[model samples]
Target chain A: MTVTDEYLSNNADYAAEFSGPLPLPPSRNVAVLACMDARLDVYRILGLKDGEAHVIRNAGGVVTDDEIRSLAISQRLLGTKEIILIHHTDCGMLTFSDDDFKRGIQDEIGIKPTWSAEAFPDLEEDVRQSLRRIENNPFVTKTESLRGFVFDVATGKLNEVTAS
Target chain B: MTVTDEYLSNNADYAAEFSGPLPLPPSRNVAVLACMDARLDVYRILGLKDGEAHVIRNAGGVVTDDEIRSLAISQRLLGTKEIILIHHTDCGMLTFSDDDFKRGIQDEIGIKPTWSAEAFPDLEEDVRQSLRRIENNPFVTKTESLRGFVFDVATGKLNEVTAS
Candidate 1:
């Protein structure tokens, strides 16, 4: 069996106890933009139940244009009003420079990608920058309640980045 | 106190039990792209542990340019070799057209976004398209193991989308 088949069978076990008619709009009226790091469990870290908030993740949790597109729908169409941007320590994004990665790709693939990796040096700075990106976007509806955070993967502690 | 403060306190409670030296490379050598829908638990649905797979989520799990960048990093920088793209039934992407959403944004903010919402009418077709996208990208390594699935929100079952 493939991994998906295993998941299909495993989901049968999860489905046995599944009780969901979960609402479309999250209960907290919030959306979380976090990193795709496996160590950070946004649900367990924030005590979010199944339907409490929309969790949007990418490589570094950077607020890219696509993320803004998602947040646009999250706020205008789905009624999510608050935005939480979370980055983490020890991120893979911190490990590489954009140019180096791009050049490496050029070497391997014979073509350079137009898109950026959006890697950053400092975690807290990236969190602040992401918050500012959301706050400054005209498409995003709920900007005033934006909060940025950096979760330490080692200690599992979340530290809020104060707005500058 | 803000919701973030509350989350910090809650995380303190969780951090008390934190035991992680989770490796950088996911044990499964896999990455999953799924939706930002609140109801879908990618981990529980796929039975992934903390250090097993990178989960890259966005609005519709669409294979955006940013997603391709992330996958490039996931394969070249990190050690992830396999990818699973999952969209779901009853998705918010199915709820609105790009033009409608852009018009709404223009009405509210006096500006039209160049970015498409990446919305689609059909789920399985979207999954197949995303799989094809990964397979076609030259920057992405390990294209052989790419798979796609549609997770049912109501039933908690994953139905694999067979590649054409």
Candidate 2:
């Protein structure tokens, strides 16, 4: 997998941006909602252009209320016409509960996780729930095509989830 | 600075999930919406717990259409009550425009950084823009006290942005 020269520190270097541009994405504009797990190389996996897609990542990528609202605006206000929800295998989010994270905060840092009640019991369930949740979400435009997939971090493959 | 036993890996043994009890956050429940920068070990720097706060990360950490919608719901529905917007001293978001990232996608795995946006052009303006973006966000419940801070990733010190 080709890594962008820009890492966390040098990402801001406009000069180092992708010099070899590819044909714009399928939609030309897309919105990606995925997990924050460092393992997932969103740009590389999606073959996306930097400015082409607005990437939104959080734990689990469960398509919560916030995600739905974002999807709604993405198609309505932003140029995006497609929604790609990526939930991958072996995500840190799937490993713990809110309490586990909270204790990490209390015992360690004085601060707390900003939002809570965000707990995903299983990985496959997260994918199933996210699909069902986004498909029915009113925030997303009814006509807008909402699709999801489970990414295999090991295989670097993307497969459509027909049921979830 | 103690790191969790959890290893950030692709083959991360998530097998324990079913057999293991869910991890819980500490007594303090705080959530953070920060940029996804490895340099910023927010939990470690802040001494946070894994589950204590709901950490939501994204590109630019810009609270646009979906972010606002999510923020509103996050406050109204989710257990979180506090929100922290942490912008680092040297950020890549300012250095590269949407075009820069879009173009750089094929060659890289992630959008890394090199030069600080500090001298590129609009330094404080970028930070101010981010601060105002979050402050003016309609989704973040005004009922919930919102705070913004710019942390010097180098020094590990924080300074609250009161202007916006």
Candidate 3:
């Protein structure tokens, strides 16, 4: 079966126990920005309930312009006041460089994307950089409460990165 | 106490029960791109185990250039071969125009971001557009297997959007 079919069947099983119309605003008023890593279960890792937090994931959990746009909506339109940036150890983002990836894509697809992969060699530095990007953005309220964290995929440990 | 403090305490409780080291590549070979809406519990809804799927989420589940970058990593570096884009009804993305949001950010932050919020007027059309994006991108292999669905926020139902 296509994964869609399987997911639909599973969703039917889930809807039997489904509870909603959950509120538009997150109960905790927090938005989490993290990677799309399969190993990092954000809900289980952060102890978030179904309707407690907005979890935004992209590669590396970098605060891109698009991510900033989302955070803006999460803060201004929705009621999320706090921002949490979570990157992880052994992340796929740390494995490649922007130049190599762009060249590889060019070789494969005949298209050189203008966008950078936003890869970084140092994990904690990347987390700190993302934290600063959010903290410095004037549109994002509650800068005083910004925090960055790095999760170890192997041991399931999270270490907070203090602002440099 | 700050939300971070609460999360840290909860995480300690969770890590005590943690199981790992799950494989880097997803077990189901699928990458799911969905919204960051707090209401949708992607794993529970799709019956996904911890390491079965890579879940990429953002404001409206719109596929951005960065999303393409992440998907490239998911397929090229990791082993994922299928992609599912799930956009839900009553998205905050439908609540504003790009021009108005840009104006608001400019007024508040004195910096007009050169980015689109990727907002949509209709949810299904947006899903169709996102599906087409995945289908059209040369960087994303296995386009023949792409699927788009709209999850009903109130009913807990997901209806597949056949490409137009």
Best by lDDT: 3
User: What digit string (tens of lDDT, one per residue) describes model 2 on residues B39-137?
Assistant: 444444454533355556554455544454445434433445666666665554555454453334323435333312122244445456656766765
lDDT of 3 by residue, A8-97 (tens): 899888877776778777888889999998887898898898788899998789988778878888887888878888998878888888
What is the C-alpha lDDT profile of model 2 across A1-164, one tens digit per residue? 11111112333332233242222222344566776444454554554433356566775676665565445444543446656678877665565577765555445546554556366777676777887886665445433455667777656566567663
Candidate 1 deviant stretches above 4 angstroms: A1-5
- Looking at candidate 2, what is the lDDT of residue A154? 55
lDDT of each: 0.84, 0.50, 0.84
Off by over 4 Å in 3: A142-144
Interface RMSD, candidates in the order listed: 1.4, 14.1, 1.4
Better candidate number, 1 or 3, judged by lDDT? 3
Candidate 3 positional error at B102, Å: 1.9
Candidate 1, A68-134: lDDT as tens digits: 9889888888888778888988899998899999999889879998988898998888888897888
Q: Can you list the residue pairs that collide in candidate 3?
A: none
Worst ten in a row by lDDT for model 3 chain A = A136-145
Greater-lDDT candidate between 1 and 2 = 1
State residue A35's C-alpha deviation in candidate 3, in Å: 0.7
Chain B alone: TM-score in each candidate? 0.95, 0.64, 0.96
